[model samples]
Target chain A: MLAAPFQAEFDANSQEFSFAGVVRPRSVDEIAHSISMFRNAIEEARGVLYINVKRLAQMNNTAFHAFSRVVLDACRTRSDIRFVVVTSSVVGWTERMFRHLGKIEPQITVEVYDSKFYPGQAFVEDTSFIPILRTQTKMTWRHERKILPRHGMRPGITMADICCGIGDFAVLVRKEFQPARIVALDHSKASLAYARDVASNFGISDIEYSYGDASEMLLEDNQFDLVTCRHSLQIFNQPDLLLKELYRICKPGGRVYITNEKNSHCLGEPRAQSIQWTYNEVARLFAHFEMDVELGPKSRRYLADAGFDDILVESFMVTNQDGDPQDFADIITAWENVYAGEMAVKRGDPPEFIKRFRQGFRDHIFAALHPKGYAGWPIWAASGRKPL
Target chain B: MNAAHRQPAEPKFEPLLQFEMEMGTFLSDWHHCDQLSTYMARMISHNRTDPLRHSNFFSSALNELLEVSFRGGSPEGRIGCAVYRHGPKERVKISFPCPAGQRQFFREAVARTHGNDAYARYLDALSTDLAPSREVVLLDLAINFDAEIRLEEQDPPSITIVVDLPLEGIVS
Candidate 1:
């Protein structure tokens, strides 16, 4: 039986059928049943059957797989029936899923329509205002010591750094590992330009910079010996798809490294306590667009699901004990700038509230700079190898 | 040789105006370029009303263009523009620093204007179909590395753009 959230309309004359609204069928059996009904309808009518998934926002991996299976099955079984899956651009994960479907079943077509729910171009385009906190809090030396050694980098090994903002990690890898070639991918043109500049300045050659959506990379399959994404997984709307892309590009036995801040642990710190509130508010704001924040612990599971083997997960923290106060101030100021501007304004936060939030953030950072005061965020490093 | 070590030269033209701003903020806001172009157009339209306004607009455009050009690189560097009135027809000369190693990029950008005659096309677009009467004219645009004005040795190399905006009714 078709569930309440699922609605289907058919125009017999036009031979067009559409299913829209929340489609949370109870189980795989229900999805199969639904596909059967669509198959029957397609047999009776002639033209294309449009599956309007624009409104189907909340779909798990199982549901996604089930949908893919049904579409592929239909395409294989019935030659007469044509299917067109329509999705919204704002639902990036859904678009990625449909794209994956197209890859598997070349005959079916998927259309992604632009919607207002999508984050404005301005929001994404403003890459010039990257917070100093991002760099300051990175603890590069620590990452170098811990993560780089495990990679066993050597000559003739090709690597790809997805979400390689400004190519910090790429530069590091080139300098430390002496990799024969490295390709850095990022979505922002401005960021890629900066990365190119950085690479030029460092006299680092053999690093190619490309700009595009990381989820849908233009690189060839099984192109790299290794792949890494640093501190960017949580921001991706569909981290699973990103991981799968990483897996796809990575050669057999090549390892994939993923790292992000442990949000829960970081938010629990006394000096970083306010970050929790801010994160929750930001998450709530993003919820309207159906984007979820990945809170650090899910990296391992995502890697495992992507068919990665020999997985290892490590968590560590960095304290600001010997850190420069000026750097901390700059980080705080950067955070304040972001919060006071688009992040707060987009959420309909009042000027007074933004001002207060900025003040509170500054106060926390100032306190963290004191002798007794301590500041840190839990960092997670998860690496896994593709099956040999 | 570092450019900053040279002795600064005296001004050859009469002082007009100066404008300065951070490049990052300007680039992040998409409307700044349009706002700047509109302001320049207005100043050109109002040149007969006040000749001094021509100098101010030249200074503003020079600063804006430099900022837009140097968006992705180090955001820390400050962009400065100085306008001076010179030449036979009260031409306002504007100069601003650009990032080092970017001279080629800027040169290509300037050369790659939509049509063959960039100045004519720019004037037409800026005037928004207004018949080109005796008003203001863009005389010339050039870029150079003046050793006297280089700010820092370690900073990205600087290229100065010289734009001559000639006011119609004034004789400097």
Candidate 2:
């Protein structure tokens, strides 16, 4: 079984479970106010050197430390500052700063949470994360503008989400887009089960969860007004065949949105060529189908190519959840759970390298999580659609 | 002019003090009013000899200040403060920062440029352009004046003008 790093690892009989009940705050106004305060604190902490240099590389320690001092100060003021209560970048940066600063202020009990993989950095760019921190602002903006959902919502639109791992988008579709029928398919039964639980809790009746290969789902062509494959397109051993199947299943005037890690590889040295190749191949396949190709932020382009014209791709930021360096330590302790087994198989790295790589990744992640704009994960998002 | 206009016992001036105190409290809470003050200050500094004639910037500033302050608080407070926003019908006194000689020259220039029939021509032009939109309001010219007087040898003489813009057009 993959390790669960960000999650608390239980010893056979431990009495200290009081911390488990920390409910992550979801009020956007509060979060925005907190972030603003955090930003201000970072600006004030002009100089300080405290960071974990595990996973990140070639980072500027001086600036990061200075920045993190401010973040740490803000975290200190907010008594409810749990590891998950802030952006991911802040968590990593703060943990490291706390280790150093906590020594000086021994009274400060900074609970450092471990980084789960490089969780805070965005795997795909999306903006839903902003609402996570600045709820009131996002709500106010919504009320002030007539900004529609990126993809238009047509009542009774039957849709399918292939590889709907955890059903993040499924929940959104049900809540915001109000789709009529949704078939969420994924290969992992555990993940599918989890998705099912969430759908049930959200009271989303239209969604039906099934465990199966996403590419092989039995569906007629032109059956869905919208089909979405988010962050799962690159995992296919046979992406070309999968694309063909997706195209075949979509109805005329119906669009498909596919999101994949750019230049994805299961194992090997990571390179720019890999990311570009993913983009290039996807673009080529869509072009061949006579679909008007609009490629850029992966999800946005995918939607556009599928012929959805009113595609909106808003970018959301992801930071180290811990807001401190202990996040790196967390990454070292939790890499297995964070990336799942595929990361090891894909990297083609030896066990020793993998172990060291994980540790090094955490170190860098810690260093990067420093305060100021200098610390934290960098992430971007894209959403597009097909025409009609 | 000073000898003839001298008010008997300065009319007690108690009402003016009360108005000032109330206005000060309002100004302290209303952040946007500072923007108006800055605008007026700059306008007076730039064209100290004349203020009322430069109604474009002054009016826009006042309008923006009123909008932000009105929306910033409860409707009750806005209604209570409406009188301050829409001043009374008495002659509007706008202070300018220039010497008496400069003010006298400016008034003469205005009179000569327009001639005796110019106010009629101005009134005709003003009536033709009173359309309304979501963005801005139009007002009719009601009063115009130019004056020059030395006050304690420190402040400049000034001109003032007034226009009748319905309260309905000035959205809170």
Candidate 3:
């Protein structure tokens, strides 16, 4: 369960000693060498020595006792150098535990680093995009409901839907699966508000909508039977970190299910070439924003590399044939606005490029509403079981 | 129902989860304190309003208790942990066979934590170069968590430490 060992590093440039992972040793005897290294770093620091415990998930009282003494003694002796305890709120006890250093000596201070985990949070969290998000979920849910059972989802199991956009899928899964518990978490406060409203209107009292950063979730380890993060991994700059978290929260023998789109593969008959060009551009546009819109087929390699066993991956197409063609058309239209109007414009694309970029989405919409049209949005669904 | 006119229902806590393990084996390693606290926190806190946050706080509090027991108690009998709740309040009861020294430690620590100068004692415990601190961990649960804690003698040489945690709001 302790995948990473306790380690400390000193950066002279930053005047910091950052500690990560579990650091519980019997007395200070086991960690005397590391403490000495930390002490040396503190002694050398001129103005300030920051002791960062942002990733230090757990520390027994024995370890903390040793650490606190070092800081206190340093404050008394090294009057010139100041001490700052940089902590992450992800580990709930850290700020409170380290706050005493600041209280005992004014030279020592504690600061909790909480925000800016998600760079694109502001843009994606805009409430105006919620309509398009709901429509995207609506179309995808049709294929996912059938695909889910094939990927270790069943009734009566505990579930967590990380990055649960607009909470539409959680509602659908709750209605379909009747899970014992469903904790739907998202970084967007606006998205969560919309999701909770939808749940309340539907009289669905079971689903718990929580606000969180998916990459560094406060959720406990091995808590859920099935952990689902749909259409989210491709958007992050670091998908591996997210996969590690998904792997951590899922119980041994439980499955982590994810879905992402290889956007360039989206096809529409009669305007296939135009649609293809637009999606390829869409992939590049997202890449410029540090996101990968073409992470679909790579799902297998990601799960396998993350030490998962019994991987299951499948591709599904949400076509104009499903429920309403307008819904499929709406998803494309919204994509054009965000991708071409917002993302492309932000990338400083010329008018000539933006004009042509907007036309492809219009053609895709026309094809979707056409009598004999077969417009399609391709998605990859993958799941891997955590080894027991 | 109107916001002002309608009366709220009375709060109650019912049995939710309970499990037991051999005290000797569990106390053999310090890591067991973390393992048990983590597993229990994740499994039990899902029913709370905010499961992840609740679990985070619960694990911190529970780990301290488990670690204290690990440091002080004898590995002679069963150590059982039971969690119960049907409302905002959740109760945790950990019962194990204790040596006289362990019992006395809890009695003195609980008394010190409940006194008017509890926060002062906690600060004093932190400032001192106390090895394997007897008071800080228990005092933290009492002061920071706003936990109501007491020790009860179940049988001769066996004792149960009960903690009532109003953990839901403090997290926010």
Candidate 4:
């Protein structure tokens, strides 16, 4: 009897129906009744459904779960009906939630757009983005090398890197693991081109570059011996969809490795405090999903639920003390490059404030380096084996 | 007549025909140096009846000079070219107005300091007897060539390099 949180209109020409408005249903009965009406409309119209979640400001977990179950059930029962969820985000945590939902129902597809920087585009064109990614690659490789061998990563194995930005990790795997072949997949052609250029520069010949959404890869099932997604899981619109794809393409007994930053801290500064506050705010926004926005502690549960076995989770801290000053500078530059624009718009910070913060942070970092300035961050590495 | 009394006919010298070209400040990046050099080479070749030989000669010569300049970390500057014809020979001289960074590199190259053996080796590889002086480095193709550096006192101080390539095989 309560008004449904969404309105559905069928387009006769396109043979598709679109749902728009807030989707925060309060109770099971309300969610069910809404799903029933949407399902009946889809069946009657005999067209695809596109749920536009742009105006969907909030969705509680119970309502979201019910909505996902109904959609999946509809897809499973009606072979002719298709469903697509379209969402956009300017912040990291919101993107994570959408991506998580994508994995919940493999039959359903989720499309996410970056509404702020690089709007509606998958590849980032900023000149500074690649350099920052390169710096982060070095930091990540150091942690990855520790556990890769134990997880079936070795010489002569076929590997697929999902969301492999710029092919840095693929090249790293080639150098360290000696994989027989590597297929680096990303959605951004620009990123792929840059990766190919880098691979060419490095004289690496065995990599096959492909561009597509990792959630729905065009790769053969059970083809890869190892699949790895590093530092990208938290930002994916549907981490679960990609994980399912990772599991599907991976050979029986093959392994999948995923790692993400838990938290980053700078020594002797207010910058760390400020960053922590921002992260907390983001986490609070998605508290309904029970997601630990910073560390992504729920990733293990998601992996297990996706039918992975012998799951292992480990944490390590990397410190920037006594490292190259240029590397430290690059880290700071990368942070500013990624978060500055979004944070500026979200927090209404003026240009002067942003500039002062960047300069102040840099000075603080340099000043802290006296008897070895300490800057450190925590990362979580989780891996699981596909059932044979 | 006595052998000394009968003076030998003065060696005939042909009238000098000159060609000049200049590039602007916009095309003054290290990467654009090759492009400008290639353009100069083509211009020299355009006037010759045997375009192939002239093109190959100028192209190789300009490329070698550009390489040495780049290896020495020379700052790219405004480029100019002058071509002169004398009898059966043609001399193509390419000049560059050097900034202080390039001037310093050239001085080190001349002094053979700062572990600059690479530039020295390039110079030695290209030297010939037709070199104007010991200080001048020549790139001796079938055509003879020589390089000279001139320093001028100005507000910022500038160095100029004049490379003279004399074509020997082609007869006009």
**Of the candidates shown, which would achieve the greatest TM-score relative to the real structure?**
3
How far off is residue A263 in model 4, in Å? 3.5
| Local lDDT at B111 for model 2 | 45
Better of 1 and 4 by TM-score: 1
The local distance difference test score of each candidate is 0.55, 0.36, 0.83, 0.55
Q: Report fnat, model 3.
A: 0.43
Interface RMSD, every prediction, one decimal place: 27.5, 31.0, 2.4, 32.8
- lDDT tens readout by residue for model 2, B87-125: 211111222233345455434433432355544443333
Q: Which candidate is the best by DockQ?
A: 3
| Residues A1-388, model 2: lDDT tens digits | 1111111211223212111111112123323443354454333432231222221211112222333344345456654332222111211222332343344333334443222222222321123322222322222223212323344345578787776666656776666667777767655544555566666687755576654444433343566776766545544434444555566556556656554433212111123233233334333333333222232245554444444455556433222333343443343234333332334434354666445444434333444344422222212233334433
B-chain TM-score of model 4: 0.46
Error in Å for residue B34 of model 3: 3.9
Docking class of 1: incorrect
lDDT of model 3 at position A128? 80
* Regions of model 1 farther than 4 Å from truth: A1-125, A131-138, A151-155, A267-276, A279-292, A350-356, B1-172
lDDT of 1 by residue, B1-172 (tens): 5789877874367654555667566546644543444344334433232222233223233433433344423455555555454442223222334555655654554443423564455334222422211111111122110001112233345444444444322211
Total residue pair clashes for candidate 3: 0
Of candidates 4 and 2, the better by TM-score = 4
Residue B158 lDDT (model 3): 73
The positional error of residue A347 in candidate 4, measured at the CA in angstroms, is 6.3
Clashes of 1: 1
